[model samples]
Target chain A: MPEKPDRNAIEVRGVRKVFGTGENAVAALATVSVSIRENEFFTLLGPSGCGKTTLLRLIAGFDYPSAGEILLYGDDIAPQPPFRRPVNTVFQSYALFPHMTVAENIGFGLEMLNKPKAEVKARVAEMLRLVRMEQLANRRTSQISGGQQQRVALARALAPQPKVLLLDEPLSALDYKLRKDMQIELKRLQGETGITFIFVTHDQEEALTMSDRIAVMSAGRILQVGAPRDIYDRPADRFVADFIGESNFLKGDVTGTDGGRATVKLSSGTEIRASLPEGFSPSGSVTVVVRPEHAQLAAADGGAALQGTVENVVYLGTDTHFHLRLDDGVPFIVRRQNARGGADSFAAGSRAGVVIGGDAAQVLRD
Target chain B: MASAEEIARAADRKDIRDRWLLSAPALIIILVAATGPLLIVLVYSFLTSAAYGGVEWKFSPEAWVSVFLERDIFDDTLSLADANITIFWRSIKLALMTTVVTLALGFPTAYFMATRSEKTRDLWLFLITIPFWTNLLIRTFAVLQIIRNEGIINTLLMKAGIISAPIQILFTDTAILIGMAYVYLPLMVLPIYASMEKLDFRLVEAGYDLYASRWQVLRRIILPLVKPGVIAGSILVFIPAIGAYVTPSILGGGKNMMISNFIELQFGQAHNWPLGSALAITVMVIVMIALLVYVRNTGAASGERRG
Candidate 1:
């Protein structure tokens, strides 16, 4: 037998999970395969009930896959129970032991290994200091705020020094500002600890902000996996592009193909050029995906543009969003800031041109 | 014209009056039927008995003193002094044993019921409570039939050649324990199920995720979380077991008499009202002390949780 590749921290191969039996059986995850690299912060992003949590539970060894296997650190851990795995999860609910103090909660995993009391104490102190929760060590979990509780949960999950930390929507419970702050903190913490982190969330912004690479899931199937920049700039399909951020899709048909670019005829009879995504087949209908920020506003007399009337202008403090409708009643969105001069104060029903460059858009087959 | 405050006050007065009008008859019945008998029992407990028979109106500390001091009175044979004390101790022991056994059996059953799926949980809970809806006396008599000489147990044992003769299971302390435990088992189960039902099961999962074994999860997390249920179920099972009249009288066969049976004997065969009242008062005092200790222990335990 040949030796296995050693770059992955977790290698999930053809894993499937089905709940119930017979006619009532429902497939939660279907032959999902991914190799998570060592010490990289990976995210599984999807809508609710999309089986991201199920995949996380499978990797944590809390549940077993009905088919295939999960390998951790080059070892198959399909039969190992959660306690036997060198991975710990910070649950969505935090799952802190209400009866235990912060210190006891953080020290529980070390105590489970029958560590010496002094060692447990020192490690617990270190973890508390890491989370900046040393002062709240004696407080009961119920006595602390939600953010503090979140810190305690992080301390508890991290104190064991596991090879992988599984976080199931850990920041979903926090307020908006706190959630934003934690996203940065979590990225820094992952770097400082150098532990492979697999974070699950329905919030696309969160996935993009903290993860080194993101596996976008939908209906139990992984649609695409790539770095944040790659995923945002070069989405493999329409679903991934739409789910990640705001995108204006114009239905089109491929007219010509060059080295790596394609010319497509839009529904409005206007021709545009875009980079062809990998594995692009030009025979069928396709969509051109352009980010809202990439679409610029120009006078209607300018060349190579689609004409539309400004339906609404929304002032969003830092930037403004323009809702435009074409003559054929096709709606499109264009985001503008004060720096872009064409439409800082366009009125409703004003004729304008929406211009997107060839490099800013990608032609998607599906 | 009435001001807003004056009108609101008038409306509140009318609401109170309407409630009083609706509840007046029930209040009168409660005052007459319930409080009247309790007042009589209190008055009887205080009054001294005349030498011939009738109760003396004059108050006296004689009965209280007889129970507390004058140790010889506890040994009095004619007045059922010795029997009363013996029955009291036996009742307490039986009650304690029954509570302990019920807890040992009921806790796991309740926990299982609480953790099961909604449909299966309802089914199990119904099975536990089905026996309670049946006649209590019929269930106790059914136990008699099962343990008798020609009962199924005896026939099976005989056929298996485990014993040459039927075991004397009826009219014994063990029989009483079995009867009382079966009769009060649902009461023990319901409160425990209620407590365990409200328990945060994530706490147990957290324990396991933290590397605790199954036993440690149970002892440190599950046990402490469901302690309120244990205490509540114990008190519920013990109080009734101590004052239980029918089960012990039917199962104990006069040999294992409890306080309830002694008190009933004074009221029936002996026709000794004052002594019966005194014995009833003693039982009440013991129950109060047991409750006090339970409350104190529970308070201390919760205090520890908070600390």
Candidate 2:
């Protein structure tokens, strides 16, 4: 056998998965396509039941696509069994064998191949060290804590040095503090291992913190695939803009277009201009997405520019958020830092002025 | 002038008395039903036999010595002593054979049932238990019908022209084994199924995901996980098979005389009560020793140290 060239770790082309037949059929993935490069930390972020984990299984060879093909390192792997494929998965449950010790669990695959006893022992020891669980090597799975068991599971999966690692909500079982800590550890581990990681999660914050590139999915379709900053700063449509992070959607109509910029007239009778993204047309109903921190609040008696009344106010230690209702009754939220004496301090139940510029918002054409 | 400590002690005594009162009736019944017979068996094993076939006032080891020494005091041409030893050995061998066969057939069937969908598993479980629904004697006789000479098997063989005369199938060790295994197969399956069903299948999948072959997953992960079930099932089948009397009697047709048959003969036809009691005592001791050895070798008792 000849050694193959380095290629994309996983490539999925037009994959479709239908759960049942006839009247009960559900199309879980519809012509979904993406390629995960080697050594990249890629996330498939979606809401629940969005076919993200299904896509990961398809790439790992645990499932077969009803209609398209999957390739591992440039060779078609759609027909290969999960064991034969050079991919390992960290399941959501951490599925460690309850009867085996931590060492035995880590060395199971090597022992399965009838490797030399000394070699298996050495590899198991090395993996234990890698996961910082050397002291727990002899402990039975039932004796360990949840986070420790998770590390043991990860060591077992990574011991084979697979070309790709698939993680399906592996951190969902941990506590909030542990989950946050593990996320950073996982990102660092991925960088050190340098294997392609296709992570499936429904958490947007986690996805934003860890991924090199993310594929946002909805209703079994890939809405956008780009760097985290691109997906967050320049979303493709209304759904992508609202799903990735908090955005105050202002319903408006496109008034004019100049190059890549568009001026839109809001239903509140305020004209806000924003730089339109590539291929966005001006002359139809559109919505502008403004981040809360981008809008400023000013006192109504100061004769400030945009007019509104403070509906609600929340002080969050670092910043204060004001919910402003304009004359047209359209609610907009504005966030301001609690700086000593900068500007624009409005009290609740008082009139306020909201100011937003073109660069602070993005026009979303649905 | 009672102190607080005295009052507390009185209350504690009352609580203990109340608990004992609640449990007394059930405990008394258990003692009568279980301990009474056991104590009688122990006392009878040590006592000397009276000439009129009742208990003697003297304590003696005469019965134990005679059984262990395999003496033939009667010195008749057809010695009952020789027959008893032969029957005891035959029974042990048949029981061992039945246990092995049952485990071989039952383990995989249990695994298959455990891994199936709930509805299909229940249907298969029902099918496995169908033969057990009939009386054990009726089922043993049904085996005799199938394998006896001039029976269904011999008739089919003759019609197929495979043999010149009816082959002798019953009245042999093979017939007794088949009957015993058929009767005890369900006993073996249920325990194994319970254990295999509790196994976490994700562990097996994890084996595969880590690049283990299918055979490796089965041998290393699945087999170890279900070992408890196998041991439990084997004990369930073997212990009962050793004491089984009706199946061998009907199917063996007097050719395969096990220990129970000899005990039955000593009491029923031979009119020797001392020897029958001796044989029963010997069988009980042997079963106890076998159970102790099994528990030690399997480390099953140690595994239960948690609870």
Candidate 3:
């Protein structure tokens, strides 16, 4: 730990936040602890009511933890108010001051810090430039479009140079195209500022696109934390694999075991080699998770493959998905990249063999 | 044969005309019933005052002149109308004080009401408007019973050993101010509450997130956003307080005669019909000025909001 290179910017140590009192109390966060590194873009991702926003609010000092320490650069910030903390939030609604001009909104935080007027002006100009909103600086927030207002909210939060910036589903309000653009823009801003950003989102795609690391949450608990590639490739559990993307789960028995790898026997009597999660020793029964793109349909000429019948065919532009039912009645999908004559290669009501690629199937821990 | 487009255009014109025709009765009633008395008052102000307490046929500017100037009996020289000016100034000052007092009391009340749950907010608003159900005269009398020397306030104070005797508070400017503020408080609270309720509390959260203290948030964000309601409430209170008759007549007694009382004296005891009309017109002018300020302020604020 002493030899670690990157310093921790924020350390939430054994935090618990329970709303209400007595029997009606709901635990929004149950003994959650995490360490976010300096200049890292960390994301807390989950579905709605998954306590991601609750954690963000606790970090931003809008609410205090029921028990535990929230340390910012090794100092406890749990007892501080939002204004007293060196953290700012870009709220979900954007919450731009409607009465003030974009420039005024940007400078509001700097002014609150008792910065010199000239310095505030300079910083406001710099923020407006950073957000590419110099043209609309003199316009009221209400006069601007929603995307522009979002930029102002970002600029306002960043004006005072907070050590940590919290974004609460900031892109959720934007349309699909704008959201896509802002995902890149937000990543770029984080890189440029070098400020530790703790983002809360329910969108897995957004978390994958912008985060340096993601903590997948569910029911007020962090199930796993890893890089996007690590998460998508080597999910820690059934929930992580199922929540992150599309997966086909097949019931299987562990026939053999190796270092971080296991041979699983499916109900169809086909043996498939799948990788195990770290420190996981599978026994009699387990679930084999496979992605559709990792599997393919082959001729059922009595080859060494799983036997299944093609139920339907979906011809996407770049790829075609073959919906198949295994001989044991477990539905499975196989996606093949479409080439010439590949679109209608497999028709409905045809017998096919299912081939799962090596290192593509994982033995998931339930 | 005419085309369908031409027929539709003709129908549209006829429909508009029919709509106006349908509204004409209400429009006519508003014009005649509202403007008729104002027109009569304006005309009366320009006519000569008869000795017997009505206007004469001859046209004269004496009533208008006496509004701001008067002739000395011995020297026969024109001098500033000190008596009328004092009464007019006192009326304006009291109206302003009433507006300030109600605002001081109403702003926090409205903010508290707006912050409550929607179901409870309606109850609070209903309570604020309970005064409106009772007659204005009766409400003023209720205030009188509370503040009078031998009334509830003094009696309670004496019984509690806080005072040796009853303090005379009934026939004072402070008494009139209290009555006017009590009567007009609902006007101030309703508009401010309307604005505060529309306020997106997330902006207050945003303020705190941006390092603003609670006081700073109130000053920079909450105050500016709710200013339109403040201006509206001030106008509502000020206009009526300027021409307040019952509250002042009862609470102020004879010693503190406001512009309304002075005007009444012109028609009742002074027997000068033209002067009374002129005084009434002056009060209208003051109200018009207050309304103008309100329009300009809210207009600018709304334009910013809309833009």
lDDT measured at residue A333 in model 3 versus the true structure, 0 to 100: 88
Model 1 alpha-carbon miss at residue A158, Å: 1.6
Q: Give the docking tier of candidate 3.
A: medium
Q: After superposition, how far is residue A347 of candidate 3 from its true place, in Å?
A: 3.6
Q: Candidate 1 chain A — worst ten consecutive residues by lDDT sum?
A: A1-10
Give the higher-lDDT candidate: 2 or 3.
Answer: 3
Which parts of model 3 are misplaced by more than 4 Å? A1-5, A21-24, A255-258, A298-305, A340-346, B1-20, B50-52, B293-307
Global fold similarity of model 1 (TM-score): 0.88
Candidate 1 residue-wise lDDT at A115: 90
Q: What's the CA error at residue A293 for candidate 2, in Å? A: 2.3
Report the C-alpha lDDT of model 3 over A1-366, residue by residue, as the tens digit: 112238899999999999999999999999999999988899999989889999999988888899999999999999999999999999999999988889889999999999999999999999999999999988978788999989989999999999999999999999999999999999889888988999999899999988989999999999898989888888888899889988888998999998889999988778889999888897999998888888877888567458888999888889888888888898888888988764486789999887787888888878
- Candidate 1 docking classification: medium
Specify the poorest-scoring 10-residue window by lDDT in model 3 chain A: A1-10
Model 1: reference contacts kept, as a fraction: 0.60
lDDT per residue, candidate 1, A111-203, as tens digits? 997899999999999999998998999899999999999999999999999899999999989999999988988987887898889999999
Interface RMSD of 2: 4.0
Winning candidate number (DockQ): 1
